[model samples]
Target chain A: MVTRGTTTATAGTTRTAEERARRVAADVPDPELPMLTIDDLGILREVHVDGSGHVDVDITPTYSGCPALEAIRADVLTRLDEHGMPDATVHVVLSPPWTTDRISADGIEKLRRHGIAPPGPAGGAHGDGRAPVPLALTVRCPRCGSPDTRELARFGSTACKALWVCGDCAEPFDHLKAL
Target chain B: MSGDTTSERSGWRSAAEPSVERVRSGARPGDVSGLVEYTLRLGDDALILSQRLGEWITRAPQLEEDVALANIALDLLGQARSLLTYAGEAEGAGRDEDALAYWRDERDFRNVLLVERPNGDFAETMARQLWFTSYQYELYDRLRASADPTLAAVAAKAVKEVAYHRDHAAQWVLRLGDGTDESRRRMQGGLAAVAPYVDELFDPDGVTGGLGAVAVDPAALREPSERHVDGVLDRAGLERPPEPAHVARGGRRGLHTEVMGYLLAEMQHLHRSHEGASW
Candidate 1:
């Protein structure tokens, strides 16, 4: 009677097949943002294995219209298959929904390294859409690290980003919007 | 119950289950009466608006606007897919999102008449967006607490996205309204044109009424939407369109404008023509 909702990845635990499956799934890179893995994006929620070694992997999307979801799903399956689990199941969950804060610190650093601006901390206590206005911090340019930037458009090439240009560096970049 | 639970625990049955079904957790499929109808009303609104927004992909006033509208359309389409898929599951009918979207006739679509209204001009488009997105923002915000887990989850994701959409619309409304005299006139006209359809969005109906806490009463969303939109209008220096004498209704019952037929034809023709062709 294995239950859901348990967190994975502590330094010292009796390693099991489920943990191995988690590592494989977590290593799958995000299709759209290749700099980060699904685990780094915090979409890889839970990976479980039954007694027969059947694997169930749960993931959530950063946004509802995230086009890379199908690719991520296929990639996870393929990675798990390479790890000797061909018949793994991936489920997309929406509860306790995905937020910008879920992007691991390493993922944020990766985005910065890749010339994309990272989002500020999503400070809303509830998913009720009423975000506290004071946290509307400036998005610095990943290139020049300048806080002087202006938005070019609210929407961008992808669903998760907004287009902005740095005033000091005069460089246009994508800022991941805090949802 | 225990026997079914035991079977569900066996792994095979739950492996290929749809996201909506699996995330619904403890709720029984098709348990909520009127759930399908209520879900379709919301789903169809998103679908139709998405189709309308998709029309602006290359045709928007600027290149940035084109990308913005396209991104917004994609988001709405995503929401529609989630909703219509959930609606199909609640119906327990073999229909899926594609079936509901591509197969349904205009008379069968449950979207509000406002969404299917032709995107007349850029100002009109912004006006329409302002009204609809603000309403959706309110709707999804309150709907996060729905008893149905799928609907609640959908609302949780949607509310965040819709806030950005509302900002886009309000930004445009302000730019056009407070700019030139000619631009102000067009924005005013655009607002007045859609005023007739506004009442129907908030009209209390049987589907929402019967669903208890599982559905947020559209009537309850009215005050907040108005408060928010009115603030935008004030800042934009645009007058509130007067309450029209005739309010268009019956969209919840599938009655739509004649233009809906044209919109439906264009949207459904590809799928209807191909029938099951996939890449």
Candidate 2:
């Protein structure tokens, strides 16, 4: 019975029912960015199973007003139901708020491979609740592996992304901004 | 941008509706009437400002500024969506966000005077943004610890977004204030024009009273809010405009300037024209 801050079991090990539930819950893809699963984005916060086999999934929205949350909620329930755990309740928690630092290493790789530049670590004074405007230190162009790039707009097609143009490749791309 | 019905624009309706229902209909919680009024005040501020910002989409000085203003507008609209929906639910009336936002007359809006003023120019808009964002940053920062969980949640999320907005406005202020002589003149005029409405932001009225810890008294935020604005002004080589003898007030009491009527008319025109419609 894992609660907050408990680590998940490693791959190739015997998985418990709770672990299996976590796996299914984590596999739900983000509605906007389909290349990365909710697990990859660090949005799938917790999955718990009781002796009665009831599962509770706690997830956080990347943005508070994110319209995609409904889609993500629907998808999470569908995925868990397909895994035979139809009695799943998805709770959206807002406290401790989400940050880009929560995205896993694998998630970064998936984003880069999908031709999107993943966000750098958040650069802000801790405990202030005001994140400094994200300054891209070295946003290497996703199309051409070049370090030369210029930000065009602080926003893009979605709230999570910023528009950038690769100076080397002369190709425009989206850089996922640190939340 | 064509004359399509709401249903014809699935993108518009999906983007417009509140994704989550924060207010559950039961015994309304925590000074229910005051809470409902307080929520409407916040929601109306966001909704009205968003409409003003949306007007800058293709009209900004540059493409980047256009995108930036549009993005800011979208964020405000998102916050408005949640707060308005919650307010409607708390009101115990059948009014949803749409009813409260589009159907209501100008006299019903509860936003502060700063947001309802017309967007005079780019510099004028920045001045309004500077004042409002700084005030919001302080308000939301404290409201994060509200006794009401929903308000706290909204504040926690909104503080992050408004931080960026405050930064954006500050940057523009510095640039325009310290730029060419003509630009500096306009920026200064903009600051003076927006100065009268600044005091009303800190006025503590009945909407915020009697709520205990759930509501933040706007007066308490005065010091820090001014500090933020002063720092930005100092950096931009600007000074606070002298307080006008007569300050505008009464937005909290739903007495807004004549501009509010025109602003609401343009905002609610399509929605009222196409009643009971969904995109």
Candidate 3:
């Protein structure tokens, strides 16, 4: 079973085929945002290995009809194939739908480093991935670390991002939307 | 179009992997036909509305609104894909999401008349969205407890989405209604034009009629939908237009307005023109 905060590198158990596969698959960068890996985005739901050594990976999407999921799947396959697992399956899960809260702290750092503002805390503590609360946060500029910024548009180049312009830096950047 | 990700080679099904169903992790619906009919309505509503929303991509009043509306359209398309896939599974018709969306004629569509109504003006579009999103918010909220796991899961995700959409449309309504005299008049006229179609959304039919615990009764959603929409209107200092003398009907029975034919023709044209083509 998969639990929160569990990643391939953190699961320090006896190395199994699944664990090795998980580690390899975890490093596959999100196709849309190459700076972030699947594990970093929190979309890699579960990695399972059957008794016969068949591997299966479950991933969630940032939004429905996110065109990136297919690319991410192919990237996962390519990574797995490179890791010597030629036959693997990728499945998409919708329940406990993907939330910005799932992005790892390290992932958030990576996003900031890559000039993208990370989402604010998961809607608010009581949101529980269900409630409809306004995610009103004062986003800091990823470039100059200035707290002055304004949302240019709610939708960015991709479904998961919102376009924001830094007040101080005057640079337009994408903010991973808090959903 | 050039950098398409998913390959059609994945196909719809594979004999080697029996566990990989279209809607992963969802239990097979109990009453297949009931679920099919019910899901088709949900899917069609989202699908049709998505196509209409897509029309505003570069044509919205503002660039930000263009991006916002496109985002909403993409979200709706995603929801429609999942529901349609589930509908196909329940129907056991071997149809995929694309087939269900592209192949169906206007008369075969089960969407409410509100969504199929053309996007007249900015105010008019917002008015239609206000009503549709409010109703959807209530319907999906109640549907979270559905007997069908697939429907429940879909609703759980959709409930949050429609909330944002509701907020977007509500903001537009408030702005347009309280703005300049000309804007206010336009907003009022938009509400009146869309008022006739509002009644049909809450009218139950064969699909939503008797599904036990699995389906949401359209009639049951009327109060909350009205309350929410009416609250937004009240905030905007606008009154609800009187119900039209002639209520539009027959959407559930696959009877659509003439605009639907033109919409379908445009939506399905490319797919029909080149079968089995991707990207």
Clashing pairs in 2: B6-B279
Chain B alone vs. reference chain B, TM-score for every model: 0.91, 0.90, 0.90
- Could you tell which candidate, 1 or 2, scores higher by lDDT? 1
- The lDDT per prediction is 0.83, 0.81, 0.81
Among all windows of 10 consecutive residues in model 1 chain A, the one with the lowest summed lDDT is A5-14
Off-target runs (Cα >4 Å) in candidate 1 are: A1-15, A125-128, A132-136, B1-16, B19-33
For B94-196, candidate 1 gives per-residue lDDT tens digits of 6788899999887888999999999989999899999999899989988888877678878887888888898899989999999999999999999998999
Chain A vs. true chain A, TM-score per candidate? 0.87, 0.87, 0.85
The residue ranges of model 2 lying beyond 4 angstroms of the native Cα positions read A1-25, A46-59, A74-92, A123-126, A144-148, A166-170, B1-30
Instruction: Please compute and give the TM-score of the first chain of candidate 3 against the native first chain.
Output: 0.85
Q: Which stretches of candidate 3 lie over 4 Å from their true place?
A: A1-15, A123-131, B1-30
Candidate topping TM-score:
1
State interface RMSD in Å for all models: 6.1, 10.4, 7.4
DockQ of 2: 0.20
Every model's DockQ: 0.40, 0.20, 0.31
Each candidate's clash count: 0, 1, 0
lDDT of 2: 0.81
How far in Å is the alpha carbon of B78 misplaced in model 1? 0.8
In order of appearance, the predictions have TM-scores of 0.91, 0.82, 0.89
